[model samples]
Target chain A: MIIALTVLLTVTGFFFFFATTIGLIRFPDFYSRMHAAGKGDTLSSLLMLLGLAIYSLHHFSFGNFLVSLKIIFIMVFIFLASPTATHAIIDAGFESGVKPWTKEEERAEE
Target chain B: MHFIYMFLIMFGFWIVLSGKFDAFHITLGVISCLIVSFLSLDLFFHETKKKGRIAEVVRFLSYIPWLVKEIVLATIHVAFIALRPNVKDNIDPKVIMFKTRLKKDLSKVTFANSITLTPGTITIKVSDDEFYVHALTKKTAEGLPGEMEERVGKVFKEFGE
Candidate 1:
């Protein structure tokens, strides 16, 4: 049961990551691509880490418990850091005057 | 009090990271944590006299599960948009700006990060009371700073109008 749960979580996480890559390629511009990279990267990494933490506890030992706790700590750190990093990147883009692509821009170009 | 709290937290972190409870290792952990905490206590707890801090922390902790749920929903939303055949038809990317009522710096930071984590919206900049955000779709753009502002404000007890 635990293994099943772990597999499900990890697979779902991978699926999100794949979608993020696709979004990065297909999105019209820098800022929109950031939308995919930022959100999808964070959620997928968190899910995969959560699955790893759970799977590490399958043997039920104090050492395993500590390891899982460490994984959670890393998750918390990522939770704080990822969005801040994304904000920094987007802020840099904004500062450098990178214009965001819009529907109207596409219509005008076509 | 802040010193003690910082020291304990640092020591607890050391224990978790070190994963060793032997007397020699434990003594080393204690000494290092003491030195580090003393050096950074002010940095760690700069607002020394804030009342109801424990309660505020509890409320914030309770807020995490809801945030996690929102993150999952956000990822799925992005995935759906990305996977659709006509991605351009699905997305209407635009920059939106708004004024926020959150006064506290921590609350404003929390609100911004929360916006970035949620579906289809990413915070581009925050200057004082104003925020500039980028939204992936019109639906998401229209829902700017909605309940999230109130929730973050409640966390910091900054019920600004």
Candidate 2:
């Protein structure tokens, strides 16, 4: 049962990461690329780590449970840090006065 | 009072993290939780508004499950949009500007973080009275400073609106 759930989580995590890569390559600008990098990257990596944590509990010893708890702690930390990092990068862009990509800019790039 | 409350929570968290109930380790946890809580209890609250702290905590605790539900729904929505071919029409990224009556700094931060955590929207700028949210679609932005604001208002009990 645990193995099945672990596989499902791993696959879902990989799917998000795959989408992040596609979105990164296909998206036209830095900010849009960030949309992929920020949201997809965070969620995918979080889910993957969560899967690993669950897998770590296969034996269910107290030590393994402790290890999984630590993994969850890391997840909580990443949950807080990843979005802050994204916001900081974008805020820096806004401060540097980089104009967001507009429809006209999109056409020009093509 | 908040200092004491903070100390208890910090110690409880420390216990969970350390997972050792030995007297020496427990003593260390108590000491650390006291030092950290004393140093940073202010960080948690901009205004500890004299209302009953227990009630406030209860309200805030109830808000978490609802927020998690929203996060899941928003994630699925974004996933669907991202998976669709030719996302140009689907993703109408734009900055939405809006004003709100939420007064406390903590509530505002909660609102902003809540916005960013949900898919399809990220808070670009936050002024005392207004927000500049960068959203991935028109539908996503349409409810800004609306339903979300109301939910946060409930959480914070922002009655002065």
Candidate 3:
């Protein structure tokens, strides 16, 4: 049962990652691409790490339990860090004056 | 009091990370935690008082499940937009600015981070009470600083009512 859950979570995470990549390539501009990279990456990594953490506890040993706890700590760190990093990157782009791609701009270009 | 709490927390972290129960390693952990906590006590607590902190933490913990649900919805929303063949027609990205009433620096930072984590919106800048956010669609753009602000306010006890 636990292994089934782990596989399910990990596979779902991989699917999101694939979607993120497609979004990154297909999105029109920098800011939009960031939407994919930042949000998708955070969720996918969280799910993947959570799966690994659960799987580590499958053996039910104290050492494995500690390792699982460590994985959770890493998840917390990533959860805090990823969004901040996304904000920083987007802020830099704004400061550098990279204009966002709006629907109006696309219509005007055509 | 704060120093002791800090030391205990740091020591707990050290034990979990180091994973050693021997006296020698335990002593080393204690020594490092003491030194580190002594050096950074102010950084950790920073103007925070002892009063109501536990209640605030409890409230914050309760907030996490809702945040996680929103994150899942957000990812699915993004994925839907990304997967659609008519992606350009779907997204109407715009930069929107608004004023927030959250006064404390910590509350403001929380609100901004929450914005970045939520659906179709990312916080670009925060200056004083003003926020500049980028929204991916008209629908998401319209939903700015809505229930989220109120929820975060409750977590931080910003709302006296």
Give the number of the best model, judged by TM-score.
Answer: 3
Q: How is the predicted docking of candidate 3 categorized under the CAPRI scheme?
A: high
lDDT of 3 at A70: 96
Question: What shift in Å separates residue B35 of candidate 1 from its native position after superposition?
Answer: 2.2
TM-score of each: 0.95, 0.81, 0.96
- Alpha carbon lDDT of residue B102, candidate 2? 89
Tens digits of per-residue lDDT, candidate 1, B81-140, equal 899999889889989899998888888899999999999999999998999999999999
Model 2: residues with Cα > 4 Å off, grouped in runs = A107-110, B1-49
- Lowest summed lDDT across 10 adjacent residues in model 2 chain A is found at A26-35
- Sort candidate 2 into its docking category: acceptable
- lDDT value for candidate 2? 0.78
List iRMS (one decimal) for every candidate: 0.8, 2.4, 0.8
What fraction of the true interface contacts does model 2 reproduce?
A: 0.15
lDDT of 3 by residue, B32-139 (tens): 998999899878777746598788899999999999999999898889889889888889999999999898888899899899889999999998998999999999
Give the per-residue lDDT of model 2 (tens digit) for B1-161: 77887888898788778888899999999888888987897788657478567877898889888776765665566566667788775676777788878898878988887887776788777878888887777777787767777878887788753
Interface RMSD, Å, model 2: 2.4
Candidate 2 clashes between residue pairs 3 or more apart in a chain or in different chains = none
- Cα lDDT for residue B150, candidate 1: 80
